[model samples]
Target: MHARTTTITADPNRIDAGIADVRDNVMPAVSGIDGYVGLSMLCDRSSGRCIVTTAWQNEQAMAATREAVLRMREHATEEFGAETPEVREWEIAAMHRLHPAGDDSCARVTWSRVDPATIDEVLDVFRTDLIPRMDEMPGFCSLSLMLDRQTGDNSLTAVYADRPSMDASRQRAMYIRDEFRRGLHMSAIDVAEFDLVLHHLRVPELV
Candidate 1:
């Protein structure tokens, strides 16, 4: 998978409108891109910083979308003003779409600092039961499960449509966690919840 991340800072006054444009206009363009697997736009309204993330089936697909992505970026800069929004990109080795939601969203950033030797049990439970159950969650439209390609630590950030939905899914997730705790596991699984803020350099639009 080819993963790309673009971080930008939006204008404080135009933050809301910019997010709208991104949702409506920019994101749709990305949705239509070649090898487009999925993407997430994470924003911080108060700080006016935005993270535009995309996942492709491969780099070739990502290459094909460059012009389209750039066009959208240019338009965003034009609409929102380029001075304040600083845009940057990063390439990820493995990308997973934890979840895809509408406008509002939430994320569960689960990371663990565990002994690599004891990972077999955690992974077994995740694959056999937890993953499937969580995938059926309401507002759980898309997901990406990434095992540290090198470290062997199970790191995942599950995405949701909104904070409320994410919050709603927790009991079920906790139930699974409790099961894991009983399966002779050691320390390592840690989860953090984040409230998604929509920000657009121009405006956040709906697709």
Candidate 2:
């Protein structure tokens, strides 16, 4: 699967309105496009940072809808009163969920860079070491790892059942993250906490 993400840092007070516009306006328009699969959103109310991601079935489908998608993105930026949004695209490397996320679910996203030659090794460690450690944490719900293999940029999101669980996992999550970084020689780019504002994505089953 392919995905496009638009990150916006906007006025904290306007986030609710922006999210409503996405749900009521942008989502319907996106759903009408050919090959459209799903849409999700993550937001940090305190910082007014939001990331909206739309998924497609293939490269061709995503490429074919670029113009329409751009318009939708522009609309979202306008609604949020945000500056030009930072846009990115990635391959959906792996996705798994122990259960569907509920309204109270929250997530932590870690962005990092690794050597392209060692991507597989990094992912192997993630699945074997990182994920298991995460699973033991209270309120763990799901995780998805996205990659831009050519650029060695990767993003991982760990979903938790509720706010307290998400908060409580911080220390151990940080330790595992450090371990992953040292083992892979990866550099951390950004890390953020967000409410799982929307979780409509239905990725194919993990192999």
Candidate 3:
């Protein structure tokens, strides 16, 4: 699968309204498009940072919708009164969910870089050593890893049942995160927490 993400840093107070616009307006318009699979949104209210991602069945589908998607992104930025957003495209390297998220669910995303030459080896380690350990964490909901194969850049998002559970599992989650970083010889670029703003997709499970 392929995905496109638009990241906007907007007015903190208006984040929810922006999310609503996407949920109630933008999504409905695009959900029926050819090859559209799913859409997810994440918001950090305190920082006014929001990330919206839409998934497609193939690169061609994603490419075909680029112009329309860009317009939607611009509309979102305008609605949120935010600066221009940053956009990216990626391949869905991995995805697994134990359950669907409830309203209280939250997520953490880590952006990093790995050696391009050893990407496959890194992915194997992630599946075998990291995911299983993460699954044991309390409140764990799901995890998806996205990759920019050309640049060796990657982003991983892990969902938790609720804010309290996410906070409670912090220490152990950090340990595992650090272990993964060290083992993969990866460089951490950015990490942030977000509320599960909107998740209205019937995306299939991939293990």
Error of 2 at 87 (Å): 0.5
Q: Please, what are the lDDT tens digits per residue for candidate 3 over residues 1-207?
A: 889899999898788779888998889988979999989899998889999999999899999998877677888898888999999999998887887888999999999999888789878987888788888888999888899988899999999999998999888888888889898899999989999978864556654
Q: Candidate 1: TM-score?
A: 0.52
The best candidate by lDDT is 2
For model 3, name the residue pairs that clash: none
lDDT of 1 at 110: 57
Model 2 lDDT tens row, 23-73? 999998989888899998999999999999999898889888888777778
The better-scoring model by lDDT among 1 and 3 is 3
Residue 56 in candidate 2, Cα distance off native in Å: 1.3
Worst ten-residue run, lDDT, model 1? 198-207
- Per-candidate RMSD, Å: 7.5, 1.1, 1.1
* lDDT: worst 10-residue window of model 2: 198-207
**What is the C-alpha local distance difference test score of each model?**
0.59, 0.88, 0.88
Please give the TM-score that candidate 2 achieves against the real structure.
0.96
lDDT of 1 by residue, 1-207 (tens): 555656566676786676677778877777766677665666555666565666667568777776767768877755554453444232342233343455577766555544556566655665666667777888774444444333555545567888778888888877765565567354456665654554221211110
Identify the runs in model 3 with alpha carbons over 4 angstroms from their true place.
Answer: none
